[model samples]
Target: MSTPALQHIAAVGAGRMGRGIAIAFAYAGHEVALIDIKPRALEATAKLETESLAEIGSSLRMLADLGMFDAGELPAIMARVRFVGLADAPAALEGADVVFEGVPEVLDGKRDAFAFICEHVRADAIVASTTSTFLVTDLAAFVTHPERLLNAHWLNPAYIVPLVELSPHPGTSAEVVDAMKAMLERAGKVPVVCAAAPGFIVPRLQALIMNEAARMIEQGIATAEEIDKATRYGFGFRFASIGVVEFIDFGGNDILYYASRYLAQAIDPTRFAPPAIVEQYMEEGRIGLKTGKGFYDYTGVDPDAYRRDVLGRSLGMLRHLDLLRAPGAALRPKE
Candidate 1:
């Protein structure tokens, strides 16, 4: 089946997320309808419209100040987004090529919004929920056409953030996913697909890291300031250059396996214990790049060249941070 062009974009529930999404698409030169799904009095609706547009305008101005684009282009970008009231939602939705539901994280609210959206939207139009709390599978049940529904989890400050996690249920159409990915890519966003799992990817990984950081502070291991500085300069900086899984392969999975065992014995066994896959991999001798295979295949790959490439990436990050210094540069003595 041919995927339709997602030219007409609409974001239901004109809250912060909707407004952010509107800015994103409008900045990308798409006309986006920021629709308010809830019924409101004329004055209340007007107030919402004012507040939403003002917030969006402020965000755009901030981005402009940060040199994202020229300040003069703000008006044109702002003009591309139209605020629609509940009365006009049907018309707005009917014309949308893709609809994003940004309603509150209440199950009943989502059910009502999806029911309203599915009624007016075209059968072919893609309906994506900009939800961080609910699963795609759970939301799909509310949609009239399950294949056209999926979850697009955008990070906060949607216009600035590059990543958008796409979670599709079993019944979701592959075409829908591809089309949405293409549209997001065109909008200068990085879209990654994940199964219908809790916390998706970033949140799931970060939860553990964040909790550990808190635990360290609670245990008097490190102050909050120190941990944050370490995270910014070391943990985040390194991970920014290489993915966690890729790092495991680069450093050798055996390192992780052994470290896991040590941590388990030293600290909390249940929390630090290695998964079965790591143990199995160690048993099978499928450790990492050193062994020609691990999380990624390195067959027919030149180890020396790959190592150089990794070093180059790390060097690039250092250069970006202005942390790279000349070989003979002298360090200043503490006064």
Candidate 2:
């Protein structure tokens, strides 16, 4: 006879990412219980999660307009979600096959929460942390069953963004890694395994760029708008499919080597040299994007419009490049 399917799941924390993660599992047909410390937080998270799902439904309806489902389907999806407080987290998690800890980005707090979870969760049940900053090995230190702990880092707005970085500590079993990956994929996420390095893969690369961008703004090398334009239109388009290493290989090692040397000499060896202008802008609180006043004024700008426009254009160009054999492939370093 076939074994029973892993059914019940629980998500700890009712923050932005926690709620999104809970909804993702619910959408995938799992029974999910969400736990938050405060009643008001739980109430707000429940409402927001429901609304976000409706927005997703609206987008799908506007685009593909799939008749197989209706807007009412959102409420049905909501029915699968249940909210609980700290006292009930254990009982709520009873029989859970997977448990995700979406706690605050604090090391100590997460340790305490995961320890509490360990007291009740099944020994074999998979436990994961949605920490973007902490290393999986470090967090796993607090887990009773370290072998079952893994870092399942999801980008913001968890349901939509396809990338889910699954990082496992040295003690973590291969089965746990595979299980987490399989389950995330089933829930409509594209899971990528990452080494337990600082900030992992994506964030590490992205951070450097952002830091340099901020520094550029401070130094007056470029305005925030210009910096974004160069990355989005100029460098972003080229880097989307083929990463930097391959780009360098394709662009010819001589240029990359010369550029590296130039940067090494011209720029301070200490971290990304916070350009003088960037320091001033940051001191004055002109941190870009979210702030209405950064290096430029986005006071009247529609943030969503920019996001949709950029992602839409990038995705379109990506598809086109794939069809054309991606000219950047020539630059990839030989394996």
Candidate 3:
């Protein structure tokens, strides 16, 4: 939004991720070329273009109605996103500032897409793969300037998600990382740099939480509705205000150390055991808030003010859920 970070953007696939990326750039006032470079029938290509544009248009209109922008500007933003067939791939990619490849998840599909995209895109262009499966290293192996390639793992509905996990290989240039981050930031995205590890950041934590939720249901700990409410009001609300590590330190690491041990013994020890780092921290006496040290340090901090801030945030969440009420509403005796 600030000075139009990238004027020329391109997405090399006509699928959901590609469409979402196109809509995002188009919304930010950049011209985007959504190119489907795979060989296909004329009818199939036309159908793909139709589907992509329709979805993008609907999304733009919804945002406009939600007061994100003037409804009159919807057509102009949608106009910025154009679809190109394989024959026009060269012109669509020429002089492009950034290219996002959102092909299928298989290695062969990714390799083929990269081999084709690399030949047309500028050597310095910030090329990125939207693959949730392979690491940046795996995909960068197909490019000539591997330093220019990175994994920009966007959450589903890229146009709405604020976080973009940027995973770079060991040899990726530092300059590229900074430039890529700047571009994403200018487009109103929060880019987090990560290693070429599997699942980047969100996916890894989400996977563990999701499977555990399913296990709880199977074990009859709570019903589906109750778990959903708890997550929405408790787990999600808290994490939304503070980072996971911050919560650990806010409540004292000793709490987690003991809770983890109890769960490990009561349930599956393999699943609930705390990491070795937790034990090491205990040994060193870094037992959070009260100790003035933990996963985070509280040294020199006004304890009362810090607690007040955290409470205010929680109260805000409660207000949003419409659960806050007057003290007089607490109870009433039945007749």
Candidate 4:
């Protein structure tokens, strides 16, 4: 089925994630309904509505103060989001083209939320769980139309983060995934699809990095401040220009193979041992740019041009960080 125009958006649960999602869509000029699905006393519900809007307004004002947009537009953006209590959830959800389930991560909570959401929303309305813990396949059991359900894992501070990882189950429809991608693209989000897996993409990669960083601290290798500085200026700087796999390809797989072997012996073999693919690549001579084969094929690519492009990307990052300087300029004494 063709994707419907996602003009109306709803975020159920009215929590931190839901508020973030609401602001993200509202910031992109879409009208959003921030619905609190739990039944509560009238006063409690009213208080929650007040708190949700207050936090959203505070975030918008902070963004405006940072020159992200004119302060004048805050009113318009804030107005685009409405707080709906449990009694109004059905009406709010029925009109949504996309419904993001942002309820707590507990299995029972998610099951009930999905059941209530599916009961209210149109069958074709995209039902995406902003779940960081559960797999899309697991949540699909709670949803009525499994094909229309998927996991959209948005990073914290979701309004600013461009990435939204879309994890679809085996039964999820291709059309549904395509439609969700289109909807996110329209909202200026970078949506990448991945199979239903633990931790999705960014989380999976980041968890390893975080654990290593913690291990370094535990081993007294570096202070927290020193590690963060190194991450910002060294590790993150290069990565901002190229992807991890691309960096391996550019540097040569042999480098990784040797380094991994050394680290495995020097530190922990379980954590540092090279995977089978790296060993296979080393044996087959698919080293990298030098060999014209690696994680990415470089067979048709011009070697010199590709190197120049990589250099350009690094230079662009240096310029962005204001670290690029003219040759011999630093050596010259200031006037």
TM-score of 1: 0.97
lDDT of all predictions: 0.94, 0.73, 0.88, 0.93
- For candidate 3, the lDDT comes to 0.88
lDDT of 3 at 237: 90
What lDDT is obtained when candidate 4 is compared to the true structure?
0.93
The digit string of per-residue lDDT tens for model 3 on 1-335 reads 11223569999889899999998888888899999999999999999889889999998889889998999998899889899999989988876888999998889988888898888987778889988999998877898788888899999899999999999898788887888888888889999999999989999999999999999999999999999999998899999877899899898888999999999999989999999999999999999888999988787999889999989988888898898987877685544
lDDT of 2: 0.73
In angstroms, the error of model 3 at 73 is 2.0
Error of 4 at 213 (Å): 1.0
Cα error, candidate 2, residue 297 (Å): 47
After aligning candidate 3 to the native by TM-score, how far in Å is the CA of 164 from where it should be?
A: 0.9
lDDT of 2 at 249: 34
What's model 1's lDDT at 261? 98
Candidate 1: tens digits of C-alpha lDDT, residues 1-335:
35577898999989989999999999999999999989899999999999999999999999999999999999999999999999999999999999999999999999999999999999899999999999998988899978988999999889988999999999989999999999999999999999999999999998999999999999999999999999998999999888899999999999999999999999999999999999999998888899999989999999999999889999999999999987756675544
